[model samples]
Target: MTVAVGAPFRTVRELWPIAWPVILSGLVALFINGNDAFLLVGSSDKVLASAVAASAVQFVAAMVVTGLVGSSQVLISRAIGSGRRDRAARRADAGLWLGMWGGTGAGVLLVFAGPVLLWLLSGPAIDGDFARAYLTVTVAALPFVGLGSALRARLAGLAQARGLLFASIAAAAVDVAVAVVLNHMIGPFGVAIGTVAGSIANALVLAWFAVRRLPAPTGVRAPRATAVFGVSRGDLRDLLALGWPEAILYGASSGAAVVVAWLLSDGPAADLAASRILELTTSSIAWIVLTGIGTAATTLLGRSLGGGDLPAFRRILRHTLIVTLSVAAGIVVLGLLLYIPILGLFAPSSVREASVPVVWLAFAQVPLMALHVPVTAAVRAMKDTRTPMIASLIAEYAVFLPLGWVLTRVIVLGLTGVFIAHVVFWVVSVLIVGIRLIGRIRTPHTLV
Candidate 1:
């Protein structure tokens, strides 16, 4: 199903097929991550804190893997768009090898360094042992996380969104079942184990689907010696060149969240719990949509650039901004309407009450986030990742963190201060990226 290069509206219509599956898959993935928090709700507050803290560390590590996988998507999409299927296949294969090795290194590091990291972030309030135990299982599963991310990127680059949906649903089902059964049998630690199992299942299913869908390698090379395990020097260089900025982007953002969590450690228990629930609810919803829209932008714009259809690329960018903003506005309204009830479902009364203002403040940032997603995605699809990375770094470190600290600590605005800083950061991000995107679109610089 080749997209029409001329008809922008028709391209928007075509996006639904791609976008819906990606959205559903992303939501399911969120569910898989949030399952532990959800299932551990009725447990003690310390247990819940431990679970959230453990998951936070794991989330940062997973984002690092995602940074690497995102580069594979860009390369694969462009290769296929330029009618270089063999190149796409090789890139995908290289991505898989990178994932395996990267995950192994991450897993080993987490096993050794995770406890100290959790200790610093969680402090003395949460159960350090419980957090460490959960972190150990989840971090050890990084290999599977890496593999799944690479496979999903390959499928997404091929425009096979349905495959990702299938893999995500299967993983979510496994996560739910294991979390429920194991939590009953083994307490909170069971949730972490379930997550690990789900990661492995997700990776295996996606790997099988990717193998079936991706083009077979050319020539008579042995399966073992062929693209299945092939890793070239050029592939490594390209991946790193495109991927390192993304790693910094994700790592910095997650690191900021860790800082916030650590700051909240000295506050009330309800505030800590509220922050987690807010993450699980409002933030999760926004990220799911953003991720889906960003994936679509990458695939469509990468293809357009590969075909040398600058007009189509620009049109795609415009359509993505319109559709994503429209969707984000709708989500913002819905979140506002359902804010109390949504928090009510997952959190106790004290936590829910404390979280309401934070959720509302977060909702206010949605439109700005909507504006930022497509612009950054367009830049990254052009293989100019550094611009967005720099923009994000400035927003996170320069604007958000310091402002949040001043508001929360200096002025004593509590959670509201942190979320206010959140809104300001998005505002800054939108302006910086918007300016860069406008310059790129107008000046007609060559995409690297």
Candidate 2:
């Protein structure tokens, strides 16, 4: 199903069919991260604090794994777009291999390093022991999570995202059921166990679909076969070159959030809880939409680039920006109208009250995020990750963190200040990427 990017309205209509399934899949993925907090919502403040802290730490690790394998989607999409089914299959296999081995190494390192890291990050308020316990269970399942990412990427790159939707639904069902059973059987630890179980289920289901979709390996073998598991040395190098920037980008962004949470740990308990609630809610909505749009952009732009269709690429980019910005505007309006009730659903009255202003502040940045997310994905689809990574570094480290520190700590602006700093980060990121994208568009012939 090749996309017709010539007509803007037709392109958008075509986009929705592809985007909705990926969006649903992203939502289900969020369930894996959010169910813990959802189940623990009305628990004691201490337990809620512990769960939030542990979850945040766990999220950073998960992002690292996902980022490391993210290039599979871009490479597979480009390969398929260029009509190289064999190469696409090989790249998929390489991603799976990397996920399995990389996950093992990461899990092992986390087992040893998690405690101290959690201790340092959790500060005096949060329960370090509980955080460490959660990390142990979830980290052990990193391989499964990593494998799931690779499979999902392969399917998405092939424009077979419906498979991911089914996998996500099944996995979410398992996650909720396991979380309930474990929560009753043990305690907060059940949430972590449930998360691991769900991740494994998700990976297994997606793997089944991915295997069926990918091409079978040819029997031909070179005189000296250097490839392992259908992936050559050059494949590994390409994956790394394309993937590391993404890893660093995800790590930096997540790390900044963790730092903000830690800084808030010294404040009131309500402040910390509210911050967590706000983060989860906003991220769930924003990321779901962003990921969906990004996937579409990646697939469409990748195919255009692969086919050397510069005009089509430009058309798709323009249409994507329009659709994504419209979506962002809608999210902003909906968030403003519904944030209070939504906050009430996940947080106690005290926490909700404390979080209202922060939620409003976050909503203000959605437009900038809407612009940044799809643009970044478009840039990545061109197989140029370094640009987005550099933009992220400057936005997070150079602008966001220092500003957040001064506002939250030095000037004592608190949560409000932290959120404002976040808005500033997005603004700068959008400017940098937007300018680069404009420059590329003007010279579309040179993009390839």
**Which residue pairs of candidate 2 clash?**
none
- Please tell me which predicted candidate would have the highest TM-score against the true structure: 1
Question: Residue-wise lDDT of candidate 1 within 20-49, one digit each (tens)?
Answer: 889999999988988987898887767787
Task: Report the C-alpha lDDT of model 2 over 1-448, residue by residue, as the tens digit.
Answer: 3344447787787677678889998888887678887888778766777778777776777778788888788998888778887777777777787777777777888888878877887765577787788778888778887888877877777777787888899899999999999998998888888998898899878867655543343221111112224468788789989988888887777776577767777777677777777877885578688779888788888888988988778778878888888988888888889879866765688788778767778888888877887788778887888788888899988998889888978998888988999889889988888888788777876587
Each prediction's whole-model lDDT (CA): 0.80, 0.79
Q: Provide the lDDT at 279 for model 1.
A: 71
> Pairing residues by index, what is the TM-score of model 2?
0.93
TM-score of each: 0.94, 0.93
Worst 10 residues of 2 by lDDT: 218-227
TM-score of 1: 0.94
